[model samples]
Target: MRPLQIGILNVMHDKAATNARFTKVLTHAGRPVALHFYYPKTHYPSGAPAEVAAILAPLDLAAAERMDGFVITGAPIEQLAFADVTYIAEVQALMAALAGRAVPQLYLCWGGMAALDYFYGIEKHLLPHKLFGVYRERRLAPAPLLAGLPDEFYAAHARYAEMDRGQIEADARLHLEATTASGELLLVDRPEANQTFMFAHLEYGREGLLHEYQREVTAHPERQYLRPAHYFTDPQTMSGPQFRWEETQHVFFDRWVDRVWAKREAKEVSA
Candidate 1:
């Protein structure tokens, strides 16, 4: 298979961890991939270094034009209103550029919510309780993203806000691919927009949730953060976390690469 170029926009606080998760699943996707990472102009975590002026900074749209596909990482600022977010405007601008380029994108968690709001006017509502756990998912539409995945499988969902199922169900613009038990949309495919919005963290490693839980507890001990659902082998004993979504994650990435390749070939032939 020919090598594909991917643009990864890191909007999260923990850049290293997110990059590691994506690299592990994508590197072995049965094709050679070259990843171009770009840090957003705003909303870096509290402890991150301040921005330094650069004459040679690679613009987001410039990067988009040179890539076959792009991925927007999940972030921790879901509770804030879209306008209230520090980098909301910057994100909107970048998304506009991606849309202008007609680049295929896979938006994760917070990224997904932001895209939904921007493109479809769909708003994210705060959950009464944090949706912190793994949940079962089933295919809703026959989309390329779910190419070889089973009819039923599990995925990790750790978010404080979610879109109303009614809004998703009513939207004819998207080809709804999968949903969780509670009718939360897990995967949405907007063929018209050429974007895939994912609510779960398929790229999470074996102990990803464990580390996340520990981090939250360490950061805010006064607030009782419930452990992730369906994560560990033994819930009562709080045993070691077991990874159950890697295979599906790999298949999804492979299929995404194939889809991007097909699009490139089609354009070449048409030209």
Candidate 2:
């Protein structure tokens, strides 16, 4: 049997470790995964612009025929119009490239915003209040990507912008997969196109949140974005919120590969 092919478009250098963990999860789930890194940070001493350029360059239509699934990582920059960001145009082009593709694709945070904007054609509103913390998001409907998830799940978040629930309801191209108690649309799943968009980070473990808090403190202390209460667990020990009814990290790749594998099997049968 051919190993499952997985491509990861990582935009942030800070998220390289998180993406690495995702690779490990896919490997542990018995799928051969290849991560294609796209780092846009110019400050890193060893960072390469050529690698970023390669991902942004153009997708080989033939290459897309081989990968089973793809995942796009989020960036820290947020704006009403995605075009305002330096690499926004390139990223949007990538999203557009993946449009109409049969393969399953999942996006996180800013990537979620990008997918929604590309597919639904709605811009994110500047949030009055910065949403920073661990919050409970209730799953709206059953989705193949979220097949095993309970109705209510916990996810980590750190953002200053959001999409209006009313607008999401009005948009026919998207479906509201989950919402918070205050009625904010948290998860939007597109079952037909084999696409999933999560506003919050499920792949982030307890330690990831802690590391983010520390990074925020060290890097942007003036912004004072670090909040202790929003974490899934405590900072020191990195355990105990038990919000999702599970201590383990959400292995999204496992679920993703399962869906893709089923699709491949069905395609083989049809052939």
Candidate 3:
């Protein structure tokens, strides 16, 4: 079998770490996978450290279209208006290029929200505070992409904006796959478009939350930042992230790779 070609648009500041996390998850699917990392040319990270910038290739729609699957990673600029984001046009262009293609697209966190807004007119709302922590979510519906994931699972979330759950539920083209007890949107499936949108960070490493918290504290010491809940083994000491979600993360990605492979097979058979 040919290696699965997966392209990731890494928008995080820590490019190397994000690349490593996704690389580990995608390769665990028991297949030879080729990972391509890209950064938005319209809004390149001018402030990124030299090493981080070195690994990022400019976002190329033609190259992305050739991949078996594509992923758009989360960005910290969730609080900005969709139109206000500098790279919105570039992202929209890429989405348009792959709109009806068989290639599977996975949009994470802010990327998910952006896709929702762009495709379905589902708007995102700002929360009173950052929703930063490990949250427990219950599966709301069955999906091939979510196969093997338990009915209840945990994923990390660190964002200041959230999709309108009601909007998603009312839409005919979208399926609300999972949610928290409070009805926070966790997973949304648009199988018609061969796309999945995830609001939580299932790909975060063991120290992901810890490192994010430390950065927040350092960046804005005067403002109170919520320590990631259900993450640290000892909240008092802020030690041990407990690494509870690695298996779940792997299962989801493994299933995603399966989905991509199945799509390719069907397309080829039809052709």
Clash counts for all predictions: 1, 3, 0
Per-residue C-alpha lDDT of model 3 across residues 1-271, encoded as one tens digit per residue: 7888889999886788999999988889788889999888878556545675689788889999998899999998999999899999999888777775657899999989999998889988999988888887888888666677777677788899999988888998899988766678788998778889988888988899888888889989999888998888899999888777777788888988888888888887998
The Cα error of candidate 2 at residue 174, in Å, is 1.8
Tens-place lDDT per residue, model 1, 1-271, is: 5677888877766667777778777776567887777766665445335442221123366667768888888888899898998778877888888888878888899999999899888878999988887888888778778777777778888889998667877888877788887788788888667798988888888887887888899889999888898889898877978788777677777777777777777776997
lDDT of 3 at 42: 79
lDDT of 3 at 72: 91
- Writing each residue's lDDT as its tens digit, candidate 2 over 66-129 gives 5677777766776446767666665665565566557677887888887887777766887876
lDDT of 1 at 118: 93
Root-mean-square deviation (CA) per prediction: 2.9, 4.1, 1.8
| Preferred candidate (TM-score higher): 2 or 3 | 3
Error of 3 at 171 (Å): 0.7
Least lDDT summed over 10 consecutive residues: which range in candidate 3?
44-53
**C-alpha lDDT values of all predictions:** 0.79, 0.64, 0.86
Top-lDDT structure, candidate number? 3
Q: What TM-score against the true fold does each predicted structure earn? A: 0.91, 0.80, 0.95
lDDT value, candidate 1, whole model? 0.79
